[model samples]
Every structure is written in structure tokens, then in C-alpha cells.
Target: MIKLKGIVAAVATVSALGSSAVFAQDVEKVIEARQSFMQLYSFNLGLVGEMAKGNTEYDPEIAASAAQNLLALAKMNNSQMWPEGSSKADAGLDEMTRALPEMWSTFPKVLEKQDALTSALENFATVAGKDLDSLRGGMKAVGDGCKGCHTDFRAKKEEG
Candidate 1:
């Protein structure tokens, strides 16, 4: 009877540890997915920005392709990456994400920012391929739209 009880207790401990491991992996996946999505945004944005800065030759085809990709990404539904308990303040996941608890607390303000991004992206998609001057002119609204959200919803990065 004593040996049987010891085996049962050991199994229970292992089971509990397994559950914790699964939870940690799930949160890590969520963090990675969101980060990947943000990278896509940056990748497309960089193409236009480099051209705007005159570092890259202003090619209409490349600008249109990049702007179209940015528009698609802006319209992607990312609700799964932002599950309620996944904020930076969540236990055991604090270091995995920079999303703030206030992002949820602020409610429709977040939605407003998203809408602004969509609007700017739509404008960019329409004008990006027209000419260099058109892309330059459209860039300010897009930058402002991005800043409006980042300033409110994201935590500021600590400079080295």
C-alpha cells in the first residue's frame, strides 16, 4: 500500500508539471505570432520609407506592391494574438510581451486607433503607385496613424 501511494503521488506531480509546460508554450506561441505580425508591417513600411528617403530608387511597381501588402496586413484580424490574459503583466508571461493591461482597460480607444490605421492604409494603397510625390504626401498620415496607436497601446522601448 505504501509503494502504491508513492507512485500515485509521483504521477500527480508529473501531470501538474506537464500542464504548466503546456501553458507556458501556449503563451510563447502567442507572443511569437504577434511579433511576426508586427515584423510584416515593418517590412512593408520599410520599402516605402527607404524610397521616401531617396536611398532606394522610387519605383512605382515596388511601391505599389509594398503598399498593397501593408494594406492587407492592416486588415488582418489579429484578435487571437491578444487574448485577455496575455498582457505583459500576466503572471509568468510578463517578460514575453510588451502589451499593456491598459490596452484592454482603455476599450474603444484601441479600436479607434485601429480604424485610423485602416484609413491611412487605404489612402496609401490608393496613392502609393501614382508617383514619388504622391507617396511622400501620403506618408505623413500613415506615420501619424501608426504613432497614435503605438503611443497609447505599446510600451516604450528602453534605449541601450
Candidate 2:
């Protein structure tokens, strides 16, 4: 059976190759795309984390924007750039992302955590334009969802 990641990857490579134009080699462009996606993800996580932990005063506008931005980034098609013989094989997964192969190996857990995130996002959207306490529970759920996946999948990067 083709794993979901494999399926998504196949499509991404096909799309990227299909959309290609003859041009100079640009590794920078690929890196830039990855960086942009990570920026969107981390930015949203920072906002949500602050709101959840009450570390920073929560504003409805900011909360709503963060929630929506996270959802949008999560939905972006980024499968193709992560090919089998990519740098990870050339180098190593630990040297890059904390995401273990278990993310794909244990797909059900990943899906469950992802579903929790989706629920959190939806709940956040519902209460996003409301007062802080109104959305507090949803924010907690969202953080938990993120941490749950991170705990098992993401590697603890060495702090330099």
C-alpha cells in the first residue's frame, strides 16, 4: 500500500517537474520556499503559544490571524521538495528536522494529532473574534496537539 506521504510526494514531484522551465540551477529558491513555510508555521505557533500560556496579552485580531495563517500554511502543497534521495538520505534527518520517520511510519498517530489540530483550529475560528477567555480552551488544545506530535516526531535540536 502506498503511504499517504508517498502519494503526496509523487504528486509534488510530478507537479514540480511538470511546471519546470529551462533555467539556471537554483538551490536557493528551494531553500527559500522551505524557509518561508517554516516562518509561517513558527510565527503562528509563537502567537498561539503566548495566548495559550497567557505569557502575552491576547488580542482577538492577532489570535484570529495566527489561527488562520497556521491553517493556511498547513494546507500548502509541499510534498515534492522532500524527495527520497533528498539531502536527508545524502546527509541525515536528525541534522535537519526533528520529524522522525515515525511521522509516516505511524501514520495513524500522526493523523490523530493532525485531527486534534484541525479541531483546535476550527474551535479557535469559532471563538477567534471573541474575548480572550472565550478562546482560551481552544488555544490549549492547539498547543497540546502541536506538542504531542513534536514530542514523538521532532528531534530535540542541540542548542548552539
For each candidate, give its TM-score against the true structure: 0.86, 0.63
lDDT of 2 at 128: 59
Tens digit per residue, CA lDDT, model 1, 1-160: 9999999999999999999799789989988999899999889999999999899999999999999998899899998888787787888876678888878988768889989989999999999999999999999888888889888888877577
Which residue runs does candidate 2 get wrong by more than 4 Å? 1-36, 51-56, 85-93
Tell me, by lDDT, which candidate is best. Answer: 1
Candidate with best TM-score: 1
Candidate 1: regions farther than 4 A off? 1-18
For candidate 1, what's the RMSD? 3.3
- Model 1 scores worst on lDDT over the 10 consecutive residues at 86-95
- Per-candidate Cα RMSD to the true structure, in Å, reads 3.3, 10.7
Candidate 2: C-alpha lDDT: 0.65
Displacement of residue 7 (Cα, Å) in model 1 is 14
lDDT value, residue 15 of candidate 2: 79
Error of model 2, residue 149, in angstroms? 1.5
